[model samples]
Target: MRLAVSALLLALVATPAAAHFQEILPSDDVLPEGGTVTIDLVFTHPMERGPTMDMARPARVGVMANGAVRDLTPAIEEKKVDGKSAWTLSDTLQEPGAAVYFVEPQPYWEQAEKKWITHYSKVIVDSYASGEGWDAMVGLPVEIEPLVRPTGLWTGNLFRGIVRNDGKPVPFAEIEVEWVNDGSVTTPNEAFITQVIKADGNGVFAYAMPHAGWWGFAALIDGPKTKAPDGSEADSELGGLIWVKASDMSAASKLLIKQ
Candidate 1:
């Protein structure tokens, strides 16, 4: 009996546990200027620990350019994913050059709480040049597509979602889900579950929930868009939010199950 118990323990140890949070972006590279970029921040946390944990809070994202780090205050738009609340940050580059930027979640939790933790990401900025004659160049506006929220049900109390863009799916996009119980509204880093997911095909992706609750989801999509020189009409690369409910499936899924 002892040997059997030891074997079971070893098996459990071999299994990989879920991470606490993640960042979703289209690519590690960005343009130096004349473009806008959007990033989605997804967080996952435990709900059984009471409503003291709030996963909703405003965060500041910073970019590294030249030899110094610059704080990027993008326009944040809020949306709901599968009934959970989420937000997106959009910003534009104004300079021309190549540099790396770091995106970090700032002051998301109270100082009194030592359990609060933060995360970060690195972004590359490319040079932007335009002129006439031999140097005559056509510039494309950069736009990052949004990541799709996870869907479907599975055993082991796990839920997953995929991140995709412009009909094409990207692999290893950062994703984070935060569970904030039923009646709470705030952001506490201790209550976040984050992970990175790679796309399979047809722009598909997935992630596993630690348990379940009202989870706020977010992701980042980056790329370029083309426009007329007049700037009257143009095509935009899309980026936005995706939300999913684990406790309940969509009507389409329900219908299929009934069928």
Candidate 2:
């Protein structure tokens, strides 16, 4: 019995750390004409795209567009993914400007890590050629204020953002990046599962995504110490996550270009 217990402990330690990302994916990040946009909120290992966890009702859900902020929490609906709870909503972008949607998810208890995770996730959507307000800050506890516009991105463009906590730059912040794998690509090793990077002295980091798909950037930071439901003291992981989708340049379209 002792030998079996020891083997169990060893196996637990050998398991790869799965990176958790809160995703606020939209049907279309850019709506040329003012229309409805559907958003999906889920807590999952996005890179692998399975084993989704139950996401409790978000503490707050809102959008900032055309210099105005509106609470959207009341419209969110509960759903299930992989037998786990998720949330979904729809919003109409009537104004012609960049709409920034933000969510503050309820703390999630992670059994394997023995901690609670809370991610403040946001995404930017553009409408009607109005290229303004893409970098507006919604005052999340932790947030990535984009230095470059988040929308209308090409696959090879460099994405830049400054990691901030309480409106102050967090120097040397650690960020984990992953591209949602559609099973079209494979990773040979564990290192390729999540690409890690650190912010420079100014709390700014940039990464150029190589593939044409949804990419998630998660800035991890230690948050207020909290306790688990089991009455055990546990650490809190606060993640400021942003999701961006890059589009590929079609070869046929390129060949037909007048230039």
Candidate 3:
């Protein structure tokens, strides 16, 4: 029995982490000049900052600007990260309003977890300082409606949102948060890798970011049972993920140098 237990522990350590974050990250949250914005769509562990899984050609890639959706799938370009397949988009929003960018990637099969995962990820970019439409909803199957404006946030500001699935609130929904590591921070243990939290009784959750960088919030929900690779029934994990950037407001607190 001791030998069996030791083998089990070894197997557990060998297993890869299951905290998958689908990132739809923009180069800037608020575009001042109103032009092209670069977006990187990657599937990986943001905090771990490695092992980016290859994503298939997404089912949909588009943006909602000025109350209309524009299909940008034809403009998506394939890229490689850590020698793994990824994607990038250079979309141009020439108006003075907020543009909501979203991506629906193909279902990814995780052989280790024996399940299929699909994450509908989104991020907002306000162009020309036009704050209108910052709260536009993508109407995804599972999504987060931000209670506070996602942009123009400081490092310590609390980000709040309501977890919704099928246009209804999901009370006590689970959420996983991670900061896009800039290779400057290291985790002391496994628990620090992905910060986990749950929604309150009203389907609202909040998290105050501790650092200045891009942060990803993913709300995972069990989707309908789907067919596995081997024609067997398997669990489906549907995620509504959003990416937000926080800035360091030290400039506001700095003493001005005398001219």
Candidate 4:
């Protein structure tokens, strides 16, 4: 019994403190005047922001805006963050509407879990007061369809979405949430690093974000068995991630007219 207990303890100790997320953060989600938007692409444990992983050239990168999908792969440029491989791109906001940028990353070989991880991530940016397309689906393999407007959100707003896989709702799907820690906030323990929640019967989930910043909601599911880098069969983790930025209520201001 003691031997079995010791093995269990060892396994628990080896588990990661929190989950990983593929982050695609933009300068601003709402463009008051509409000009240019710079996007930062990185793969990391956002809350901890350490041990950054090298992201291979993404399999696909594009944007859906103005009722059309545009390939933005040519715009991707290499960047280095803290001496680790990263990517950056810029998109000019020429039209009025919502643009959804998405990335399908090449499967990452995680040696610790002996599984491949692929997160289909995306973020929405609204331009020039256009708000009609914020809820449009990008048709990723796995995705979270937002039930609320993604941008222009207050800090205490509740985020709601339906976890979908292959155009179908995944009932009782598991979701993991984390903030892009800018080093201002500190967590008390491992549990605070990643907040976990689940969808209901309709594959709908809700999370009330208490703080202001970019919050990532990832709907995780098991993908088809695939070969690892070593040519051996391994499990795959497919994450449907969506990023939303929340602004502080105190930031809103009342305009005074000159009498």
- In the order shown, the candidates' Cα RMSDs to the true structure are 17.9, 2.8, 2.7, 3.5
Backbone atom clashes (below 3 Å) for every candidate: 34, 0, 0, 0
**TM-score attained by model 2:** 0.93
TM-score versus the correct structure, for each prediction: 0.33, 0.93, 0.93, 0.92
Residue-level error in angstroms, candidate 2, position 40: 0.4
lDDT of 4 by residue, 1-259 (tens): 9999999999899766558899999999999788899988899989887668999988889999987999998899999988888899999988888999999999998888889999999999999968779999999999999999999999999999999999899999999999999999899977799999999999999999999899999999999999988898999999999999998866554322322
The number of the candidate with the highest lDDT is 4
Backbone clash total, candidate 2: 0
> How far off is residue 112 in model 2, in Å?
1.0
lDDT score for residue 234 of model 2? 91
- lDDT on C-alpha atoms for all candidate structures: 0.40, 0.91, 0.91, 0.92
Residue 87's lDDT in candidate 1? 54
**Residue range with the least summed lDDT across 10 consecutive positions in model 4:** 250-259
Q: Model 1 off-target regions past 4 Å?
A: 1-15, 24-34, 44-55, 106-116, 127-259
lDDT of 4: 0.92
TM-score of 3: 0.93
